[model samples]
Target: MSIPLAVVAGASGFVGQHVVEALRRQGSEVRTIGRGSVADATWDDPGAIEQVLAGADLLVNLAGRSVSCRYGRRNADEILRSRIGTTAALGRALANVGSPDLLWINASTGTIYRDARDRPMGEVDGDIGSGFSVEVARAWERELWDAPADVRRIALRMTIVLGAGGGAMSPLINLARIGFGGAMGDGGQKVSWVHVDDVVGAILHLHRHPEISGPVNVVAPDVVTNAELMAQVRGSMGRRVGLPEPRWLLEAGARIIRTEAELVLKSRWVAADVLHESGYEFSHPTLASALAEIAGRAPRGLLPVALG
Candidate 1:
């Protein structure tokens, strides 16, 4: 069989970088689309995108403005536009040049679900939430599904991704190091997370199992409350104390840092129902194991140094 060709957009991002590397290691030829000159095709040129996508077996679109900042009017607009515009552009290009065999896995988010402290949200029965973030997620998936049915598509609804160099882990690690990594608010909010490796693994699994399509939750089976999460972070960092931040304090701190408090305050209780039922085992299935692996690979000073 001939080698598979994969075209990845937003290949410069943290998750995209990992996906590109994984694809390359699997011996598949990878092409990228981004504003950067290094990409095979830039998003500005529809013709170039079509050219790069032609004859490609897979297309992974991770293009979006990072949501780590304060969701001001301008930031919110950019976030929505970046995701929807990129997705629509790709959809249009694929409709014009893509083959039926091509698989397009687009990035979605578990934040699309309501702030659920009640139950875990899954692909089948998860209640769609409202607000700016949820609307963004909904619109993002809608764009993917709006694409022609002949082109296979999977909306990978990922939760908070934990990795060594970057991702949601960085801020938390920083918090722990600075003695501020305690429970935020009431600490009842569920933090549904997945290891970065599992994210890549789920992608590969979904690619091989063509039977699975639609919205698939890319989260680990294990979930934890905010208190438990921070406790683990403290444990991982060998910190004996972490100053918990109440809601008011958290909101104030969020304002000071220019980020939305909803990032930590929202109870994101999501379940990897499709991934579990499909028999895709996770490398870092538990919070402890995930943190251990991340801590191992993390920078030297991030964690407490051992003393004799």
Candidate 2:
């Protein structure tokens, strides 16, 4: 007979804001903890966050430096530090709290899985990849493992989240408009994606389903190839064609953009096996339909695409 109080760390981010809005829409009281916002407290004040968590039913940590930038020495270090530091800090805070019913949902990436061109990777059988991104993801989940024994924890191995305004969809839409939204690196790489709304829904579902824990794949049922993904973007934007970018060209473009080609070049064929087994139906299951919905709400602007 009481509404749940959800405390969202890193609440000012693109996904964080959407998750907060979704929680509020579901009649839950939301408190945010992050830097420079009117959160309950910033990361600098861990005690205040602990106080907030004591009264919370759910704690979702979406804090991390965006991996969309160029992975230079400085950037790469910060990327690792931000995720591990935030998760460790949250674990410390949770340790101080006495709430047994608290559920912590931390952000993990589907990129942790190897470049699986063979078949779709799932929670049970997916092979973990090595390298900078995969290492960061592994450490991120390790922090969660150190949390108190009483707390329930789940690491969302999220794929590329498609949404309006600030996600993979916006830049792809821009590229489609500019007639450069083409398949990269032979366009055979598999791209696993999920709608932002479904992401929110899945988080809530996991919160209610205590039977599920550990790293769960949060992607959609339908995964598309790089060529099909570009074609869908072009189709949604009313364009017929996109110039294909080869690996050499992608490397050059990545240097120019100060980012890596791995974001687009790597094959990430992931599936939501846990969610499917738990009976969680996706709101936007297919790439074409998901892109159409996002495109309708996407702002009309020529913002440069930063494929992460």
Candidate 3:
């Protein structure tokens, strides 16, 4: 028996770093691809990418620009280009040197599903949404599936990932501390979220279960409404008061912050049917549990501060 080789692209991002550490802890040799000097291969050089990918047992591509910006013309174009271009590039590389034994897990978003307050969106029955974000998600997955590689591929349609140190938790914690932790807009939109630990766990689980392929929703089964989410945020931080923001105010604040309100306003009722059916037990299955663990790891005074 020999150690496995895992090649991870975009290894500098928050999630990517965790994935790399997890793989290394499991005794797998890790290679990274990015624009950074730490990367074994840069995206600019297709030859180097192919070389690094060759003979690797696993390939995880988390390459994509952050969508945490206002969707202006320039940012929107780069968002789409970053995702589709990197995915297509990997596809080309894999076509040249891929094998049936290799497994490619590409990053995707659960936002591809329509904003549904009516029902939960599953992989099989979820309705694809419209708009810029949805289009980007669609194109990102399309590029992955259209690849001519002989290897198995899984488009990880992840939802809002919460964790300590980085991710959506920081901003939310800030909002709570500032006394704006109340619900956004109507506060009825369903939020489908997963802990970062579960994201890593699901990836390893998928790698082990070769039978699971195609688009898989990497989210927790428990979904919470916007109001419920905010309430939990306040509780975790020991905040006594939280002022709710209406849609109009949210739009204004979004412009001020250079981020979109859809990030919080949209109803994302996603169901992890595949993970559930496939028996992937989530470590933080509920929003309460997830937030508690995340708050525990956060810096002192950042959470559980003196209530105001």
Candidate 4:
């Protein structure tokens, strides 16, 4: 049997790398397009995009600047431009193609939902937030929605993705190792998250389920609070205690790290309603089990120093 051809934009990213590997593992011929790779065509070249789309059975756009930094004006502009611009560019290329790809799965974020400490948000009834990150997500989705109807499109509103290498888990792991993985702020904010394996599985499921379209929350059914999340990290790392970070301290540290406190402060209570109804089973549903799987063994040799 011949393998399907997949064109993945921004496969170099943390999630994208895993997606590409998953595709290839499932017997798909994957071609990556990025600015850094001379072998692949760059996003600027409309001809390159159309060429890839023409032959591709799937088109996955994960191209965007990381939003893990302080949002100054210049940084904010780049963030918006990287997401919205790349999405628009891909739409134009898809339009020019002879036949649109079977499906286009563009990356979105669960942060698009408001800070709901009360209830879980889903695609049908989730409240969208305002400001830079929310605005970027809104506009990014618009680009995919406005694209030609020939291709089926689904915007994956992903939550905090946990894995071995990167995505939102690394820094937290490092912080735990150094004995600083504790609750931030009031520790009441909901932490909606998913394991990387589930992330890959969700993408594959979405690809197969042509009946599903639009925004779907890709998160584990098991949700945790900031306190519970840190507790799990501490337990996995074989630590007894962690120093809690107050809101003022969190704000100060974020400024020093050149990142935004909103990354830590905001409450993201999202649920995988679409995936649940689709009957997709999650491999690592609980936070503790997922952390243990990622850790693999007993974590030893702590720094003996703690951070506030």
Candidate 5:
């Protein structure tokens, strides 16, 4: 049998790029269908999106406006609209052209969970947060649940991805390399995160294991607070640093980053029970190991980003 084909909706984004690489590593023929791609059609054009999705063996929908900035009312509206619209459009397309029994992986976020004071929020946790991110996630999932009958679907609720570019660690790494690296806010807020490599791996795992459906939190099995993360990162960068950026300073930094300080400096220790329970093993689940690998320091037990 010939290798099956896969199409990633948001093919050019940070996470989407890694997902593409992962799919290719698994020997799947891949295609891109997003705004900036060389493809002539945007999903917004009538009958455009469905045509692209009709015959694919697998579909990974990661399309969305970037959440990297402070979301005012307008930005938040776009975020929700971009995701919901694409999802609904895809569903309509599948319904029309007769979709195959293929896996449809959609993007959700760990921020949908409750406040971080709860610490290590598990997958089974009933309460979800109600911020702008949460709104985008809830609407995205709703579209998937309401999708046409032929599409087999899974929602990979992602955590903050730590990678060299366009993920959590990039900006922080740049700042740290410049000696501006310090723990933001009180440094007490938990920030559950995963390496971008792991994000790609988790996506491919779900693609292979058809039973892994619904909302699987794609985060490191271990949890780390802001201070601990900062400390480990500083050490990895070879800096003996303890300079703390107060809450107000972080608020100012937020203005420059366009994203709010609360979003970045806030506590959110999300758990990975679903991914773990599904037999997904993490090679870099802890802060030290992840940092070591990212910093070009050789990590012993972990699968390096280069490996992914």
Candidate 6:
């Protein structure tokens, strides 16, 4: 029998590439679309993406503009417009073509929620965020939901994905290795983090067990404050110089870096009840162990056998 095919978008980004590799490991074929020349479709060519999706087993949309760019009306607007526009175009294409009964997974963000006191935010707990990241998430998710119901769909509200390769964790990991990584602001704000392996693993679960739908939280169970995270990184890296940047310093730095002061200084303690309750197993459920493995300080755990 032929293996099922998946139409994957955003093949150039960190998680997107990881997803493609994960699927390949599971013996599934993948076709992609994006500008990096890695994916099969370029940004403006919706028909190419649509053609990729036609008769495919899955449609995974992970395309978006990175929100870490320096803050400006134009820059922030581009971030929002890129996500909204890509999602809109994809949705229109999916609607126009007779979509297969394949599963559709749209990428969202944990930044959708406002701050709370270490509270574990869930799917129904509405208070979607207010910053440029939140705005992008809001519009991106809306366009995703606009698709026809014939294709089963789900939105993955992802947290800060950590690994040795790419993402928000990369710069921090490098600083930590040099004994310079430290808390951003007051050290009181929380951070929700997940291992890149677990992020890819959970999607593998979705690929095999298609019943899971709606907005799934792709994060680790334990959330940490900036102080605690810095402490762990310092301890794990065997470092002694990690320190806290004062709020004023971070604010000033944000302006120079072209990002919002709040992005660097704010707390985001998201959770993953959806992933847990549904029997989705996480390889690095804890933060310390996850950090250790990523830093090559610990042994790689037993690899899970990928399902078809």
Write down the lDDT of every candidate, Cα atoms only. 0.90, 0.87, 0.90, 0.85, 0.76, 0.75
- Which tens-of-lDDT digit does each residue in 1-308 have in candidate 4? 23398888998888889998989998998988888864277887889877877778788889998898878888898999998888888888878784554788899999999998999999899999887889889999998999764788899999999987667776787678777888999999999999989988998888778799889999998899999999999888777788889999999988887888898889999999999999999999899779988888424443222221
- The sequence of per-residue lDDT tens digits that candidate 3 reaches over residues 116-228 is 99999999999999998999999999999999898999999999999998878888898898899999999999999999999999999898787999999988988999999
Q: Between 4 and 6, whose lDDT is larger?
A: 4
Root-mean-square deviation (CA) per prediction: 3.9, 1.6, 3.4, 3.1, 4.8, 5.7
For candidate 4, give the lDDT of residue 263: 89
TM-score of each: 0.96, 0.96, 0.96, 0.94, 0.89, 0.90
How many clashes (backbone atoms < 3 Å, residues ≥3 apart in a chain or on different chains) does model 5 have? 4
User: Candidate 1, residue 31: CA error in Å?
Assistant: 0.2
Residue-wise C-alpha lDDT for candidate 1, range 167-215, written one tens digit per residue:
7888888889899989999999999999999999998888888898899
CA displacement after TM-score superposition, residue 153 of candidate 3 (Å): 0.7
Q: How do the residues 129-203 of candidate 2 rate in per-residue lDDT, one tens digit apiece?
A: 999899999989988897654688899999999888776776788778888988989999999998888988898
Better of 3 and 4 by lDDT: 3
Q: Report lDDT (Cα) of residue 94, candidate 3.
A: 91
How high is the lDDT of residue 293 in model 6? 81
Off by over 4 Å in 4: 1-3, 297-308
Candidate 6 residue pairs in clash (backbone atoms < 3 Å): 32-40, 33-40, 33-41, 70-258, 70-259, 71-258, 112-129
Between candidates 1 and 6, the one scoring higher on TM-score is 1
Clashes of 6: 7
